[model samples]
Target: MALTPPAWRHTLTEVPRGAAGVLRLAGKWRAMATGPRGRGEPVMVLPGLFNSDRSNVALRRHLTRMGYRVEGWGLGRNLGQRAIGQDGERLFARIDAMAERYGAPISLVGISLGGLMARIAAHRMPGHVAQVVTISSPFAGPPDATRVWRAYQALSGARIDDPEVRALVGEAGRPLSVPTTAIWSASDGLVGGAICRGEDCAAVEVRSSHVWVQFNPDVLRAVAVALAT
Candidate 1:
């Protein structure tokens, strides 16, 4: 049986206003100024829920300039729950294909729920996955941080206590067989930073909004470091 989380867990809310957004951009510049160089295998960028591949275009271009093979999730518009089925299967297949084409394992860089999905895919296909880097993902637990996410969970029939989701989350929190890095922020207006914790995961705290994690420079630098490792 899956463990039931405390009711207060669902009350963690998004940061009021968009302060996190401003801080995110600032952190990006800071990362550019001090980040280390990148040298590693290809990287797969997974956008957050309700976001599209276009969302990480800037980050991808930047990483590409830094000498990394950066690719997107190629699926169409991110329509949240709907993207989890056929689209997800196709995405996983693409990861497999990319691994073969590169002749090397691929690193997964997922944002928000996409991070959760990436972890699941990595676990399912460890051979193709080199490293896992998540940005503000709630891997430690369920979607109980905000009313919107709770509603999404209900509407999508994603029971936090469901055996599958629970099992996935539990495994995600355990030591990843491959290197793993989790970038989190106390300023995140969506998921709480607490869920970002893991014993085997290298955790980096950046100042950014939950929505702007893909664009945050510090997070990207941390991702680059993790991939280069």
Candidate 2:
């Protein structure tokens, strides 16, 4: 079972704390110092809700330097359900196209809501997706566990408590056919880390703020290692 959701205090203080974390990116740069090259395989990076591919730019750059062919989701800004409506067939088609382009399975690294989407894609198309890595994504609990649920509902026009939404979230939490890794943070200011885990995937814990998790150097290194394997 997933752990209890974090209290409102943590969620409320997220932005300033996360900004501080973002400012510390320079330190992470110094720490990571060098990049370890990968097998030059195809990797796709998906951004979180309300964010576009731009959010994964830093992570993508790091992966590219590591000799991996990383690309963004390309379906425009992630306005949650609004991007693909409810069915998500369009997103699936995009994943299929990326797989066909390389003629090989693709590894996915997604942040926040993107991670859940990646998990769903992997579950649906194991042949196309070789591995999955999620950073600060809530896969094990209700959507309401996230402090940003209101924003999601406002932007996506989907109610979190809806039975269909709950069912879908539950399905994404199940084991996936591909190798999976979930990178979570106890200090996450937005969604609680407890809900970011999956039973089938190995879980790696990090110290990062929610907004900065994608850009944090440690998280980047973890993602690189997952991609390499």
Candidate 3:
């Protein structure tokens, strides 16, 4: 049995909380810059499945004000392999270009599936990525554990059980050469929050619904805290 997807109660609460997140983002966005400010560090924020860089504008915008040099992937919508390349060569290219442009390792802040990819990218190109911060990304559990499995298959054009994909997912759960922060919520409705915790990462709980964990004002503070330290 899939030990995830949360309970019916949590799943049911997603829509309402997710709706509130939008309002909170617009009105309570100041918290995003409350933590330790950045010192011109290169930070890249990756969008979730089916999302584009546009989805992260609020978060990235504040990060810039906090003093970090922030940028979106600029690769357009995230269609899994269609965007990152079958072997993730495209992701590697992005990392390489950013590292070159920044003249230093870049920090990766990813939401949901994007977080999984960020972890994988850090592993593939060790030291190129300074650190990784995952928001509600289930890298530490079976991909099927999430309610988004069918959506993943439809969008990524790959099965969760496919040998190659399985290997990559497995790799993402392992310890990284750089620091990692796994920010998840027990109140999440779509995926198992437990699965989001990495083996050797700093785990933070924000008690949010899965749909908009990335947009929550408190989540913004969490991200700022993660990057600052």
Candidate 4:
């Protein structure tokens, strides 16, 4: 099936929902621990485009409470290739470091562009990555399928059809040896959810606009379930 950007209605609601998500934060982050507990496994939480590891504080805290050792991407802000490097060597190094430190594979949980990058790590170094969870990431779709395509192009100074860019995108979409889950929502406003998951990957649906998908309570619960089982 073909992929396209989300409709204007969903896009329009993103801001308000983002605000609401912040308020909703007051409710119950503890619910995340109800599902299951971790055994101090290293888990990396990757932020979306233009966002820093700071963006996923709620999720990270919840995961930590669930017994997993969660850490942010450590890289400042997510500027796509600019942040991860031309061939993603920096991201690979981060994964390698975590794996070596833990003496075990680390799970990758990323939102939007971060999710795409997470899949690339799993594809390129499956042994180091135990599993992957992509939130609202359109890795299985074309760049234009998301509202951020032009912004991404501007940030990276590269066109979507560039040969190297295409190769990099190809790496992101390759099948992985580890458990891979794609979490998306039909209510998403920035990117079409249809493109978020490939047929080969497990899919979980939640209700959220693109801006707050990673922070939404239901999304947090979904992430917990994905990581737990």
Alpha-carbon TM-score of each model against the true structure: 0.80, 0.92, 0.95, 0.95
What C-alpha lDDT, on a 0 to 100 scale, does residue 220 get in candidate 2?
87
lDDT of every model, 2 decimals: 0.71, 0.83, 0.86, 0.85
Candidate 2 C-alpha lDDT tens digits along 1-229? 5455577677677777777666777667656646566877999998998888888888898888888888999888787754444658888888899889999999989899899889888888889999999999998788877777888888777888877667668777988988999999888877888899877889999888887678777788889888777
What C-alpha lDDT does candidate 1 achieve relative to the native structure?
0.71
For model 1, residues 45-164, the per-residue Cα lDDT tens digits are 988766788888867876776778889988765544455453557877889889998999898888887787778778878999988898888888656543246645655566666666
The reply for model 3, stretches above 4 Å from the true place, is 84-87
lDDT of 4 by residue, 49-125 (tens): 88998889989998888889999988888888765547477888989999999899999999999998898888878
User: Which stretches of model 1 miss by more than 4 angstroms?
Assistant: 1-34, 79-88, 146-148, 154-163
Candidate 4 — number of clashing residue pairs?
0
List where candidate 2 sits over 4 angstroms from the true fold: 1-3, 30-35, 83-87
Candidates by lDDT, descending order: 3, 4, 2, 1
What tens-digit string does per-residue lDDT give for candidate 3 at 1-229?
4566788898888989987987888887664556599899999898999999999888898888888999998778787656544746777898899999989999999999889889988988887899999999989889878888889899889888888778878888898989999999898888888899967899999878888777788788888889999
Residue 156 lDDT, candidate 2, scale 0-100:
73
Global Cα RMSD, each model: 4.0, 1.9, 1.6, 1.4
In model 1, how large is the Cα lDDT of residue 172? 64
Lowest summed lDDT window (length 10), candidate 2: 79-88
